[model samples]
Target: MSTRQEEATWTTLETFDVEVSSPSNRLYRNGRQQVEVTVKLRARNEDGRIVPLSEEQKRSVRLIDYNSGEVLPDIPASGTVATGWGTTSVRNEYEFFPGARDGMPGQIGPAEGYTFVVRYVQTVDAAPKRIGAQVRRDAQTVFKTNADNVQKSIEAVPERLPSFDERATSVEHGWESQRVVGDENDWDLRTVDYYFCGLSINGNRVKLREFTVRPASMFQWESTNPASEIFSFTGFGTPGSSMAQYNVPAAFSDRRHNPISMPSDGRGIVVLIRSNGIAQSSAGNVHKGACDVDARDEFGTDHPLRVSFKSSSNRNELVLTRR
Candidate 1:
Protein backbone atom coordinates (compact mmCIF):
# COMPACT_ATOMS: atom_id res chain seq x y z
CA MET A 1 0.00 0.00 0.00
CA SER A 2 1.14 3.54 -0.74
CA THR A 3 0.89 6.28 1.91
CA ARG A 4 -0.27 9.81 1.08
CA GLN A 5 1.69 12.88 2.31
CA GLU A 6 0.00 16.06 3.47
CA GLU A 7 1.34 19.61 3.43
CA ALA A 8 2.63 20.87 6.77
CA THR A 9 1.40 24.21 8.07
CA TRP A 10 3.30 26.66 10.26
CA THR A 11 1.97 29.51 12.35
CA THR A 12 3.35 32.27 14.57
CA LEU A 13 1.77 32.97 17.95
CA GLU A 14 0.91 36.42 19.35
CA THR A 15 1.88 37.23 22.99
CA PHE A 16 -0.31 39.36 25.28
CA ASP A 17 -0.77 40.04 28.96
CA VAL A 18 -3.48 38.19 30.94
CA GLU A 19 -4.06 41.30 33.11
CA VAL A 20 -3.45 39.31 36.32
CA SER A 21 -0.77 41.52 37.96
CA SER A 22 -0.24 44.60 40.11
CA PRO A 23 -1.43 48.12 39.16
CA SER A 24 -5.17 48.02 38.48
CA ASN A 25 -4.63 50.13 35.33
CA ARG A 26 -1.13 49.92 33.75
CA LEU A 27 2.57 49.90 34.75
CA TYR A 28 3.87 53.11 36.39
CA ARG A 29 7.38 54.18 37.47
CA ASN A 30 6.76 56.07 40.72
CA GLY A 31 8.57 53.30 42.57
CA ARG A 32 9.47 49.70 41.85
CA GLN A 33 6.14 47.95 41.26
CA GLN A 34 6.04 44.17 41.46
CA VAL A 35 4.34 42.98 38.27
CA GLU A 36 2.97 39.49 38.05
CA VAL A 37 1.99 38.77 34.45
CA THR A 38 1.04 35.53 32.68
CA VAL A 39 1.90 35.84 29.00
CA LYS A 40 -0.28 33.68 26.73
CA LEU A 41 0.60 32.40 23.25
CA ARG A 42 -1.91 31.43 20.62
CA ALA A 43 -2.08 31.16 16.84
CA ARG A 44 -4.55 32.61 14.33
CA ASN A 45 -7.46 30.54 13.15
CA GLU A 46 -9.72 30.75 10.08
CA ASP A 47 -11.65 33.51 11.90
CA GLY A 48 -8.51 35.69 12.14
CA ARG A 49 -8.78 35.57 15.94
CA ILE A 50 -6.37 34.13 18.49
CA VAL A 51 -6.64 30.38 19.11
CA PRO A 52 -4.79 27.69 20.97
CA LEU A 53 -1.21 26.92 19.95
CA SER A 54 -0.18 23.75 18.19
CA GLU A 55 1.56 21.02 20.16
CA GLU A 56 4.28 20.84 17.52
CA GLN A 57 5.54 24.26 18.52
CA LYS A 58 7.93 23.63 21.39
CA ARG A 59 8.78 26.89 23.09
CA SER A 60 11.41 28.20 25.56
CA VAL A 61 10.53 31.61 26.87
CA ARG A 62 12.13 34.43 28.95
CA LEU A 63 11.24 38.00 29.94
CA ILE A 64 12.91 41.42 29.59
CA ASP A 65 12.16 44.56 31.56
CA TYR A 66 10.74 47.28 29.32
CA ASN A 67 12.39 50.28 30.91
CA SER A 68 15.87 49.01 31.74
CA GLY A 69 16.05 46.34 29.01
CA GLU A 70 17.20 43.92 31.68
CA VAL A 71 16.68 40.32 30.58
CA LEU A 72 15.37 37.87 33.15
CA PRO A 73 16.20 34.21 33.59
CA ASP A 74 14.78 31.83 31.06
CA ILE A 75 11.63 29.96 31.88
CA PRO A 76 12.23 26.52 30.39
CA ALA A 77 9.83 25.34 27.70
CA SER A 78 6.72 23.52 28.83
CA GLY A 79 3.70 21.83 27.18
CA THR A 80 5.70 19.98 24.53
CA VAL A 81 3.99 17.29 22.53
CA ALA A 82 4.47 15.28 19.39
CA THR A 83 0.93 15.53 18.06
CA GLY A 84 -2.28 17.56 18.51
CA TRP A 85 -1.12 20.33 16.18
CA GLY A 86 -3.52 22.93 17.61
CA THR A 87 -5.64 22.18 20.67
CA THR A 88 -4.18 23.78 23.78
CA SER A 89 -3.09 27.14 25.21
CA VAL A 90 0.60 27.27 26.13
CA ARG A 91 1.81 29.96 28.47
CA ASN A 92 3.93 30.79 31.57
CA GLU A 93 3.78 33.19 34.50
CA TYR A 94 6.63 35.70 34.88
CA GLU A 95 7.35 37.50 38.16
CA PHE A 96 9.33 40.71 37.69
CA PHE A 97 9.33 44.46 38.46
CA PRO A 98 10.01 47.53 36.31
CA GLY A 99 11.99 50.78 36.83
CA ALA A 100 15.29 49.24 37.96
CA ARG A 101 18.42 51.41 37.87
CA ASP A 102 21.84 49.92 37.20
CA GLY A 103 23.93 51.62 39.89
CA MET A 104 21.17 53.17 41.94
CA PRO A 105 20.12 52.01 45.40
CA GLY A 106 17.59 49.20 45.70
CA GLN A 107 15.04 51.68 47.01
CA ILE A 108 14.92 53.81 43.84
CA GLY A 109 14.36 53.31 40.11
CA PRO A 110 15.42 55.16 36.95
CA ALA A 111 14.03 58.61 36.11
CA GLU A 112 13.37 57.47 32.53
CA GLY A 113 10.54 55.47 30.96
CA TYR A 114 10.21 53.24 27.92
CA THR A 115 8.23 50.35 26.45
CA PHE A 116 8.58 46.79 27.81
CA VAL A 117 8.75 43.71 25.63
CA VAL A 118 7.92 40.04 26.05
CA ARG A 119 10.27 37.70 24.20
CA TYR A 120 9.57 34.16 22.94
CA VAL A 121 11.80 31.46 21.49
CA GLN A 122 10.61 28.33 19.72
CA THR A 123 12.51 25.07 19.54
CA VAL A 124 11.62 24.50 15.90
CA ASP A 125 13.91 25.95 13.23
CA ALA A 126 13.05 29.64 13.25
CA ALA A 127 14.13 32.99 14.62
CA PRO A 128 13.23 34.07 18.18
CA LYS A 129 9.88 35.91 18.58
CA ARG A 130 9.14 39.02 20.60
CA ILE A 131 6.16 41.34 21.36
CA GLY A 132 6.06 44.92 22.54
CA ALA A 133 4.28 46.01 25.76
CA GLN A 134 3.83 49.31 27.56
CA VAL A 135 5.74 50.14 30.76
CA ARG A 136 4.53 53.20 32.69
CA ARG A 137 7.54 54.79 34.33
CA ASP A 138 7.64 58.47 35.44
CA ALA A 139 11.39 58.71 34.85
CA GLN A 140 12.07 57.52 38.36
CA THR A 141 14.76 54.87 38.99
CA VAL A 142 14.08 51.18 39.27
CA PHE A 143 16.47 48.58 40.46
CA LYS A 144 17.56 45.27 41.70
CA THR A 145 22.23 29.19 44.53
CA ASN A 146 21.36 25.92 45.58
CA ALA A 147 24.35 24.53 47.35
CA ASP A 148 24.26 21.50 49.73
CA ASN A 149 24.36 19.25 46.66
CA VAL A 150 28.12 19.57 46.67
CA GLN A 151 30.09 16.87 48.52
CA LYS A 152 32.98 19.25 49.06
CA SER A 153 32.99 21.71 51.97
CA ILE A 154 33.64 25.01 50.18
CA GLU A 155 36.20 27.26 51.93
CA ALA A 156 37.82 30.67 51.38
CA VAL A 157 40.77 30.90 48.97
CA PRO A 158 43.77 33.17 49.48
CA GLU A 159 44.21 36.18 47.21
CA ARG A 160 47.36 34.47 45.89
CA LEU A 161 48.42 30.97 44.95
CA PRO A 162 51.81 29.33 45.42
CA SER A 163 54.30 30.47 42.76
CA PHE A 164 55.48 28.01 40.08
CA ASP A 165 59.08 28.43 41.34
CA GLU A 166 58.30 26.80 44.74
CA ARG A 167 58.94 23.10 45.44
CA ALA A 168 56.01 20.72 44.79
CA THR A 169 54.91 19.53 48.23
CA SER A 170 51.42 20.96 49.06
CA VAL A 171 48.13 21.26 47.12
CA GLU A 172 44.88 23.28 47.37
CA HIS A 173 41.92 24.50 45.27
CA GLY A 174 39.54 27.55 45.21
CA TRP A 175 37.68 30.07 42.99
CA GLU A 176 35.92 33.52 43.22
CA SER A 177 33.31 35.62 41.39
CA GLN A 178 34.07 39.27 40.61
CA ARG A 179 31.44 42.03 40.77
CA VAL A 180 30.77 44.84 38.22
CA VAL A 181 28.09 47.06 36.75
CA GLY A 182 26.46 45.34 33.77
CA ASP A 183 24.99 46.95 30.63
CA GLU A 184 25.72 47.28 26.93
CA ASN A 185 28.92 49.11 27.88
CA ASP A 186 30.13 46.34 30.23
CA TRP A 187 32.85 43.79 29.38
CA ASP A 188 31.66 40.98 27.18
CA LEU A 189 34.38 38.36 26.88
CA ARG A 190 35.62 36.72 30.03
CA THR A 191 39.22 35.48 29.98
CA VAL A 192 39.97 31.96 28.75
CA ASP A 193 41.87 29.81 31.27
CA TYR A 194 45.06 27.76 30.88
CA TYR A 195 46.82 25.29 33.19
CA PHE A 196 50.27 23.78 32.56
CA CYS A 197 52.43 21.26 34.42
CA GLY A 198 56.15 21.01 33.69
CA LEU A 199 58.49 19.81 36.51
CA SER A 200 57.58 17.15 39.08
CA ILE A 201 59.12 16.15 42.43
CA ASN A 202 58.56 12.83 44.27
CA GLY A 203 54.99 12.36 42.97
CA ASN A 204 54.25 15.89 44.12
CA ARG A 205 51.34 17.63 42.36
CA VAL A 206 52.52 20.99 43.74
CA LYS A 207 54.07 22.19 40.48
CA LEU A 208 51.35 24.25 38.75
CA ARG A 209 50.72 26.46 35.74
CA GLU A 210 47.67 28.65 34.98
CA PHE A 211 45.94 30.92 32.40
CA THR A 212 43.28 33.51 33.28
CA VAL A 213 40.87 35.97 31.63
CA ARG A 214 39.50 39.28 32.87
CA PRO A 215 36.98 38.90 35.71
CA ALA A 216 33.22 39.25 35.07
CA SER A 217 31.00 41.84 36.68
CA MET A 218 29.78 40.58 40.03
CA PHE A 219 26.56 42.62 39.88
CA GLN A 220 24.65 40.97 37.08
CA TRP A 221 21.67 43.07 35.90
CA GLU A 222 19.81 40.01 34.81
CA SER A 223 20.72 36.44 35.57
CA THR A 224 23.23 36.61 32.70
CA ASN A 225 24.74 39.13 30.33
CA PRO A 226 23.97 39.12 26.61
CA ALA A 227 27.70 39.53 25.96
CA SER A 228 29.70 36.54 24.72
CA GLU A 229 32.48 36.71 27.34
CA ILE A 230 31.76 33.83 29.71
CA PHE A 231 29.66 31.99 27.16
CA SER A 232 32.77 31.63 24.96
CA PHE A 233 34.77 30.18 27.84
CA THR A 234 33.86 26.55 27.36
CA GLY A 235 36.09 23.44 26.92
CA PHE A 236 36.75 20.00 28.37
CA GLY A 237 39.88 18.04 29.26
CA THR A 238 41.42 16.16 26.33
CA PRO A 239 43.36 13.57 28.41
CA GLY A 240 46.70 13.86 26.57
CA SER A 241 46.18 17.20 24.86
CA SER A 242 49.05 19.61 25.62
CA MET A 243 46.81 22.68 25.32
CA ALA A 244 44.70 24.61 27.88
CA GLN A 245 41.61 22.95 29.40
CA TYR A 246 39.13 23.48 32.18
CA ASN A 247 38.97 21.43 35.45
CA VAL A 248 41.85 19.22 34.25
CA PRO A 249 44.84 20.22 36.34
CA ALA A 250 48.21 19.05 34.92
CA ALA A 251 49.39 17.53 38.23
CA PHE A 252 46.67 18.96 40.52
CA SER A 253 44.29 16.06 39.96
CA ASP A 254 46.51 13.80 42.05
CA ARG A 255 45.99 16.00 45.11
CA ARG A 256 42.38 15.02 45.61
CA HIS A 257 41.88 12.96 48.81
CA ASN A 258 45.64 13.33 49.37
CA PRO A 259 47.28 15.16 52.27
CA ILE A 260 50.63 16.94 52.70
CA SER A 261 52.92 17.62 55.66
CA MET A 262 52.16 20.40 58.20
CA PRO A 263 54.85 22.92 59.09
CA SER A 264 56.20 23.07 62.65
CA ASP A 265 54.55 26.52 62.95
CA GLY A 266 51.27 25.03 61.66
CA ARG A 267 50.94 27.35 58.62
CA GLY A 268 50.75 25.73 55.19
CA ILE A 269 50.52 26.97 51.57
CA VAL A 270 47.27 28.13 49.92
CA VAL A 271 46.22 27.83 46.24
CA LEU A 272 43.20 29.53 44.72
CA ILE A 273 41.28 30.06 41.43
CA ARG A 274 38.55 32.53 40.45
CA SER A 275 35.29 31.75 38.67
CA ASN A 276 33.45 34.19 36.38
CA GLY A 277 30.23 35.87 37.45
CA ILE A 278 26.78 34.29 37.07
CA ALA A 279 25.34 37.79 36.42
CA GLN A 280 23.25 37.85 39.63
CA SER A 281 24.22 39.99 42.57
CA SER A 282 23.29 42.97 44.81
CA ALA A 283 25.33 46.16 44.97
CA GLY A 284 27.22 45.00 48.07
CA ASN A 285 26.59 41.31 47.54
CA VAL A 286 27.68 39.72 44.29
CA HIS A 287 28.87 36.21 43.43
CA LYS A 288 32.19 35.27 45.09
CA GLY A 289 34.48 32.21 44.59
CA ALA A 290 36.88 31.20 47.34
CA CYS A 291 38.26 27.95 48.83
CA ASP A 292 40.97 26.81 51.27
CA VAL A 293 41.90 23.14 51.20
CA ASP A 294 42.51 21.59 54.60
CA ALA A 295 45.50 19.43 53.71
CA ARG A 296 45.77 16.93 56.53
CA ASP A 297 48.72 14.82 57.54
CA GLU A 298 48.29 11.28 58.97
CA PHE A 299 46.89 12.98 62.11
CA GLY A 300 43.68 14.26 60.43
CA THR A 301 44.29 17.68 61.99
CA ASP A 302 43.13 20.70 59.90
CA HIS A 303 45.85 23.31 60.29
CA PRO A 304 47.79 24.41 57.23
CA LEU A 305 45.98 25.88 54.19
CA ARG A 306 46.42 24.51 50.66
CA VAL A 307 44.67 26.26 47.76
CA SER A 308 44.19 25.64 44.04
CA PHE A 309 42.01 27.34 41.44
CA LYS A 310 40.40 24.99 38.93
CA SER A 311 40.28 27.30 35.89
CA SER A 312 39.57 26.56 32.23
CA SER A 313 41.22 28.42 29.36
CA ASN A 314 41.73 27.71 25.66
CA ARG A 315 44.45 30.34 24.95
CA ASN A 316 46.46 30.75 28.16
CA GLU A 317 48.84 28.60 30.25
CA LEU A 318 49.98 29.08 33.85
CA VAL A 319 53.51 27.79 34.41
CA LEU A 320 54.13 26.26 37.84
CA THR A 321 57.87 25.83 37.36
CA ARG A 322 60.68 28.31 38.15
CA ARG A 323 61.75 30.83 35.47
Candidate 2:
Protein backbone atom coordinates (compact mmCIF):
# COMPACT_ATOMS: atom_id res chain seq x y z
CA MET A 1 0.00 0.00 0.00
CA SER A 2 1.28 3.46 -0.93
CA THR A 3 1.07 6.22 1.66
CA ARG A 4 -0.53 9.50 0.67
CA GLN A 5 1.39 12.77 1.25
CA GLU A 6 -0.35 15.39 3.40
CA GLU A 7 -0.44 19.00 2.26
CA ALA A 8 0.08 21.57 4.97
CA THR A 9 -2.62 24.18 5.41
CA TRP A 10 -1.61 27.65 6.58
CA THR A 11 -3.92 29.83 8.69
CA THR A 12 -4.11 33.51 9.68
CA LEU A 13 -4.38 34.22 13.39
CA GLU A 14 -4.28 38.01 14.00
CA THR A 15 -2.71 41.33 13.09
CA PHE A 16 -2.02 44.55 14.97
CA ASP A 17 0.32 47.55 15.21
CA VAL A 18 3.76 47.15 13.62
CA GLU A 19 6.62 49.64 13.45
CA VAL A 20 10.30 49.83 12.41
CA SER A 21 13.05 51.88 14.07
CA SER A 22 16.60 52.66 12.88
CA PRO A 23 19.23 55.37 12.98
CA SER A 24 19.35 57.87 10.14
CA ASN A 25 21.43 56.99 7.05
CA ARG A 26 23.87 59.87 7.29
CA LEU A 27 27.23 58.14 6.83
CA TYR A 28 30.57 59.90 6.67
CA ARG A 29 33.03 57.36 5.17
CA ASN A 30 32.84 54.92 2.26
CA GLY A 31 32.89 51.52 3.92
CA ARG A 32 30.59 48.87 5.39
CA GLN A 33 28.13 50.13 8.03
CA GLN A 34 25.46 48.31 10.02
CA VAL A 35 22.36 50.05 11.42
CA GLU A 36 19.63 48.00 13.10
CA VAL A 37 15.89 48.51 12.54
CA THR A 38 13.50 47.04 15.09
CA VAL A 39 10.27 45.44 13.86
CA LYS A 40 7.34 45.10 16.29
CA LEU A 41 4.19 43.02 15.66
CA ARG A 42 0.89 42.24 17.36
CA ALA A 43 -1.45 39.28 17.03
CA ARG A 44 -4.41 39.30 14.64
CA ASN A 45 -7.34 37.08 13.82
CA GLU A 46 -8.49 35.51 10.55
CA ASP A 47 -10.25 38.72 9.56
CA GLY A 48 -7.00 40.66 10.02
CA ARG A 49 -8.22 42.19 13.26
CA ILE A 50 -6.28 42.85 16.46
CA VAL A 51 -6.34 40.24 19.24
CA PRO A 52 -4.33 39.09 22.21
CA LEU A 53 -1.31 36.97 21.23
CA SER A 54 -1.01 33.61 22.96
CA GLU A 55 2.35 32.51 24.27
CA GLU A 56 2.70 30.08 21.36
CA GLN A 57 1.85 32.79 18.83
CA LYS A 58 4.73 34.96 20.01
CA ARG A 59 7.19 35.25 17.09
CA SER A 60 9.52 37.62 15.26
CA VAL A 61 8.55 40.56 13.02
CA ARG A 62 9.71 40.89 9.41
CA LEU A 63 11.08 44.08 7.84
CA ILE A 64 12.24 45.66 4.55
CA ASP A 65 14.05 48.85 3.59
CA TYR A 66 12.85 50.60 0.40
CA ASN A 67 15.37 52.98 -1.02
CA SER A 68 15.68 54.75 -4.38
CA GLY A 69 12.67 52.78 -5.65
CA GLU A 70 14.29 49.38 -4.90
CA VAL A 71 13.84 46.76 -2.16
CA LEU A 72 16.71 45.46 -0.02
CA PRO A 73 17.39 41.81 0.82
CA ASP A 74 16.86 39.80 4.12
CA ILE A 75 13.29 41.03 4.15
CA PRO A 76 10.52 38.82 5.48
CA ALA A 77 8.23 36.64 3.45
CA SER A 78 4.57 35.86 4.38
CA GLY A 79 3.26 34.65 7.77
CA THR A 80 3.31 35.94 11.39
CA VAL A 81 6.75 37.47 11.96
CA ALA A 82 8.49 37.16 15.35
CA THR A 83 9.51 40.14 17.51
CA GLY A 84 10.52 41.28 21.03
CA TRP A 85 8.18 43.39 23.12
CA GLY A 86 8.40 45.46 26.27
CA THR A 87 5.38 46.10 28.46
CA THR A 88 3.86 48.29 25.72
CA SER A 89 5.41 47.43 22.30
CA VAL A 90 7.90 45.22 20.50
CA ARG A 91 11.50 46.48 20.35
CA ASN A 92 13.31 45.05 17.31
CA GLU A 93 16.77 45.75 15.82
CA TYR A 94 17.76 45.85 12.11
CA GLU A 95 21.22 46.45 10.62
CA PHE A 96 21.85 48.35 7.40
CA PHE A 97 24.30 46.94 4.88
CA PRO A 98 27.36 48.80 3.60
CA GLY A 99 27.33 51.52 0.92
CA ALA A 100 28.77 55.07 0.52
CA ARG A 101 31.22 54.55 3.44
CA ASP A 102 31.03 58.33 3.03
CA GLY A 103 28.25 60.60 4.33
CA MET A 104 24.93 61.66 2.85
CA PRO A 105 24.18 65.33 2.23
CA GLY A 106 22.90 66.82 5.51
CA GLN A 107 19.22 66.26 4.64
CA ILE A 108 16.47 63.68 4.79
CA GLY A 109 16.35 60.59 2.53
CA PRO A 110 13.56 58.13 1.68
CA ALA A 111 13.21 54.60 3.14
CA GLU A 112 10.10 52.62 4.01
CA GLY A 113 8.59 49.14 4.31
CA TYR A 114 5.77 47.09 5.91
CA THR A 115 5.20 44.39 8.54
CA PHE A 116 3.74 41.00 7.65
CA VAL A 117 0.60 41.90 9.63
CA VAL A 118 -0.25 44.84 7.32
CA ARG A 119 1.42 47.29 9.72
CA TYR A 120 3.82 49.59 7.90
CA VAL A 121 7.29 51.11 8.30
CA GLN A 122 7.45 54.82 7.50
CA THR A 123 11.02 56.08 7.75
CA VAL A 124 13.07 59.06 6.56
CA ASP A 125 16.65 60.24 7.14
CA ALA A 126 17.15 63.50 9.03
CA ALA A 127 20.68 64.90 9.40
CA PRO A 128 21.30 68.05 11.43
CA LYS A 129 24.49 69.99 10.79
CA ARG A 130 26.97 71.34 13.40
CA ILE A 131 28.74 74.68 13.39
CA GLY A 132 32.14 75.59 14.84
CA ALA A 133 34.91 78.16 14.35
CA GLN A 134 38.70 77.63 14.13
CA VAL A 135 41.12 80.39 15.10
CA ARG A 136 43.45 81.53 12.28
CA ARG A 137 46.29 84.04 11.89
CA ASP A 138 44.17 86.76 10.28
CA ALA A 139 40.58 85.48 10.61
CA GLN A 140 38.54 82.67 12.09
CA THR A 141 37.49 79.73 9.92
CA VAL A 142 33.92 78.55 10.46
CA PHE A 143 33.07 74.85 10.04
CA LYS A 144 29.55 73.53 9.62
CA THR A 145 29.04 69.79 10.02
CA ASN A 146 26.68 67.19 11.49
CA ALA A 147 26.73 63.58 12.64
CA ASP A 148 26.65 62.69 8.95
CA ASN A 149 29.93 64.55 8.41
CA VAL A 150 31.42 63.39 11.74
CA GLN A 151 31.29 59.65 10.95
CA LYS A 152 31.08 57.52 7.83
CA SER A 153 28.72 54.97 9.42
CA ILE A 154 25.10 55.15 10.44
CA GLU A 155 24.72 56.46 14.01
CA ALA A 156 21.98 55.56 16.47
CA VAL A 157 19.21 58.11 16.63
CA PRO A 158 18.78 59.73 20.06
CA GLU A 159 22.56 59.45 20.21
CA ARG A 160 22.29 59.57 23.98
CA LEU A 161 20.86 56.64 25.91
CA PRO A 162 17.80 57.24 28.07
CA SER A 163 18.77 59.36 31.06
CA PHE A 164 17.87 58.27 34.60
CA ASP A 165 15.66 61.34 34.92
CA GLU A 166 13.77 60.48 31.72
CA ARG A 167 11.93 57.61 33.37
CA ALA A 168 8.60 58.68 31.94
CA THR A 169 9.42 57.43 28.41
CA SER A 170 8.39 54.01 27.16
CA VAL A 171 11.97 52.70 26.82
CA GLU A 172 12.81 53.70 30.38
CA HIS A 173 9.61 52.17 31.65
CA GLY A 174 10.43 49.00 29.78
CA TRP A 175 13.76 48.92 31.53
CA GLU A 176 11.95 49.36 34.83
CA SER A 177 9.58 46.51 34.08
CA GLN A 178 12.54 44.22 33.50
CA ARG A 179 14.25 45.23 36.71
CA VAL A 180 15.60 42.40 38.86
CA VAL A 181 13.80 41.13 41.98
CA GLY A 182 14.61 39.00 45.07
CA ASP A 183 17.81 38.25 47.00
CA GLU A 184 21.18 38.36 45.26
CA ASN A 185 21.81 34.68 46.01
CA ASP A 186 18.40 33.57 44.65
CA TRP A 187 16.96 35.86 41.96
CA ASP A 188 14.24 36.36 39.37
CA LEU A 189 14.31 38.44 36.18
CA ARG A 190 12.14 39.90 33.41
CA THR A 191 13.39 40.54 29.90
CA VAL A 192 12.42 42.89 27.09
CA ASP A 193 11.67 41.04 23.86
CA TYR A 194 12.67 42.39 20.42
CA TYR A 195 11.87 41.22 16.92
CA PHE A 196 14.73 41.26 14.43
CA CYS A 197 13.81 43.10 11.25
CA GLY A 198 16.66 43.72 8.80
CA LEU A 199 20.15 45.26 8.47
CA SER A 200 21.23 48.18 6.24
CA ILE A 201 23.66 51.07 6.25
CA ASN A 202 23.07 54.78 5.59
CA GLY A 203 24.68 55.09 2.15
CA ASN A 204 24.86 51.37 1.37
CA ARG A 205 22.79 49.45 -1.19
CA VAL A 206 22.82 45.76 -0.03
CA LYS A 207 21.19 43.91 2.87
CA LEU A 208 23.62 41.95 5.07
CA ARG A 209 21.68 39.95 7.68
CA GLU A 210 18.20 38.71 8.74
CA PHE A 211 16.51 37.73 12.01
CA THR A 212 13.13 37.43 13.75
CA VAL A 213 12.30 36.69 17.46
CA ARG A 214 14.73 37.38 20.33
CA PRO A 215 14.75 38.48 23.98
CA ALA A 216 15.96 42.00 24.76
CA SER A 217 17.50 40.92 28.06
CA MET A 218 18.32 37.40 29.41
CA PHE A 219 18.32 37.12 33.22
CA GLN A 220 16.51 36.03 36.40
CA TRP A 221 14.38 37.97 38.93
CA GLU A 222 12.21 37.87 42.10
CA SER A 223 9.50 40.02 43.76
CA THR A 224 8.91 41.60 47.20
CA ASN A 225 5.87 43.23 48.82
CA PRO A 226 6.61 46.92 48.26
CA ALA A 227 8.48 46.34 44.92
CA SER A 228 10.45 43.87 42.83
CA GLU A 229 14.20 43.34 42.79
CA ILE A 230 16.86 42.18 40.35
CA PHE A 231 19.33 39.61 41.74
CA SER A 232 21.08 38.67 38.52
CA PHE A 233 21.22 39.64 34.82
CA THR A 234 23.30 38.90 31.76
CA GLY A 235 23.37 40.64 28.43
CA PHE A 236 21.83 39.16 25.30
CA GLY A 237 23.93 36.35 23.90
CA THR A 238 25.72 36.77 20.59
CA PRO A 239 24.42 35.09 17.46
CA GLY A 240 26.25 31.94 16.39
CA SER A 241 27.68 33.62 13.31
CA SER A 242 27.14 37.34 12.88
CA MET A 243 28.91 40.69 12.59
CA ALA A 244 27.70 41.88 16.02
CA GLN A 245 29.28 40.84 19.32
CA TYR A 246 29.21 42.29 22.90
CA ASN A 247 31.77 41.21 25.52
CA VAL A 248 31.11 41.95 29.20
CA PRO A 249 34.32 42.63 31.07
CA ALA A 250 35.32 40.25 33.85
CA ALA A 251 36.54 43.17 35.97
CA PHE A 252 34.11 45.67 37.49
CA SER A 253 34.34 48.96 39.41
CA ASP A 254 32.72 47.69 42.60
CA ARG A 255 31.99 44.20 43.90
CA ARG A 256 30.46 43.04 47.22
CA HIS A 257 27.08 42.10 48.69
CA ASN A 258 25.42 44.89 46.69
CA PRO A 259 21.71 45.13 47.09
CA ILE A 260 19.51 46.20 44.15
CA SER A 261 16.51 48.24 45.32
CA MET A 262 13.38 49.26 43.47
CA PRO A 263 12.82 52.06 40.91
CA SER A 264 12.03 54.82 43.44
CA ASP A 265 15.00 54.09 45.68
CA GLY A 266 18.37 55.32 44.39
CA ARG A 267 20.52 52.92 46.44
CA GLY A 268 20.98 49.87 44.20
CA ILE A 269 24.30 49.28 42.42
CA VAL A 270 24.78 48.79 38.65
CA VAL A 271 27.09 46.80 36.36
CA LEU A 272 28.13 47.64 32.79
CA ILE A 273 31.06 47.90 30.38
CA ARG A 274 32.40 51.38 29.73
CA SER A 275 34.95 51.94 26.97
CA ASN A 276 34.56 55.72 27.02
CA GLY A 277 35.90 55.87 30.63
CA ILE A 278 33.07 58.12 31.82
CA ALA A 279 30.90 57.65 34.89
CA GLN A 280 27.17 58.27 34.97
CA SER A 281 26.07 61.00 37.38
CA SER A 282 22.70 59.58 38.29
CA ALA A 283 22.03 57.05 41.04
CA GLY A 284 20.37 53.59 40.95
CA ASN A 285 21.24 52.98 37.30
CA VAL A 286 22.39 49.86 35.44
CA HIS A 287 23.78 49.51 31.94
CA LYS A 288 25.06 46.32 30.33
CA GLY A 289 27.49 47.24 27.58
CA ALA A 290 28.49 50.59 29.06
CA CYS A 291 28.20 50.36 32.88
CA ASP A 292 28.73 47.38 35.15
CA VAL A 293 27.47 47.20 38.73
CA ASP A 294 29.20 49.28 41.39
CA ALA A 295 29.28 46.59 44.04
CA ARG A 296 29.89 47.58 47.65
CA ASP A 297 28.36 47.31 51.11
CA GLU A 298 27.98 49.97 53.84
CA PHE A 299 31.65 49.63 54.68
CA GLY A 300 32.79 50.07 51.04
CA THR A 301 35.16 47.24 50.04
CA ASP A 302 36.44 46.10 46.64
CA HIS A 303 35.74 42.54 45.56
CA PRO A 304 34.85 40.69 42.35
CA LEU A 305 31.40 39.21 42.55
CA ARG A 306 30.82 35.78 41.08
CA VAL A 307 27.83 34.25 39.33
CA SER A 308 26.14 31.95 41.83
CA PHE A 309 23.47 30.74 39.40
CA LYS A 310 23.82 30.45 35.64
CA SER A 311 21.49 29.11 32.97
CA SER A 312 22.12 29.81 29.29
CA SER A 313 21.09 28.39 25.95
CA ASN A 314 21.05 29.20 22.23
CA ARG A 315 18.54 31.91 23.02
CA ASN A 316 19.87 33.54 26.21
CA GLU A 317 22.62 33.75 28.86
CA LEU A 318 22.04 34.49 32.54
CA VAL A 319 24.30 35.35 35.50
CA LEU A 320 23.13 35.64 39.09
CA THR A 321 24.88 37.86 41.64
CA ARG A 322 26.50 36.46 44.75
CA ARG A 323 25.50 37.62 48.17
User: Mind giving the per-residue lDDT tens digits that candidate 1 earns over 1-323?
Assistant: 11111101212233323222222212212111123333333334345543333222222223333333344333233422222111122232321222242332122111221112223211221121121122211123111100221232211110111122133244332222222213323334332232222222335322222222212111112224343222222222221323322332233233121121211122222212222333222223332232222232211112233122233332111212111
Cα lDDT of model 2 by residue, 228-273, tens digit? 3333333221112222222322332232112222212212212211
- Model 2 residue runs over 4 Å out of place are 1-25, 28-31, 46-60, 65-71, 74-323
Residue-level lDDT for 229 in candidate 1: 26
Question: Candidate 2 at residue 227, lDDT?
Answer: 34
| Cα lDDT listed for each candidate | 0.24, 0.23
User: What would the TM-scores of all predictions be?
Assistant: 0.17, 0.17
User: What TM-score would candidate 2 get against the native?
Assistant: 0.17
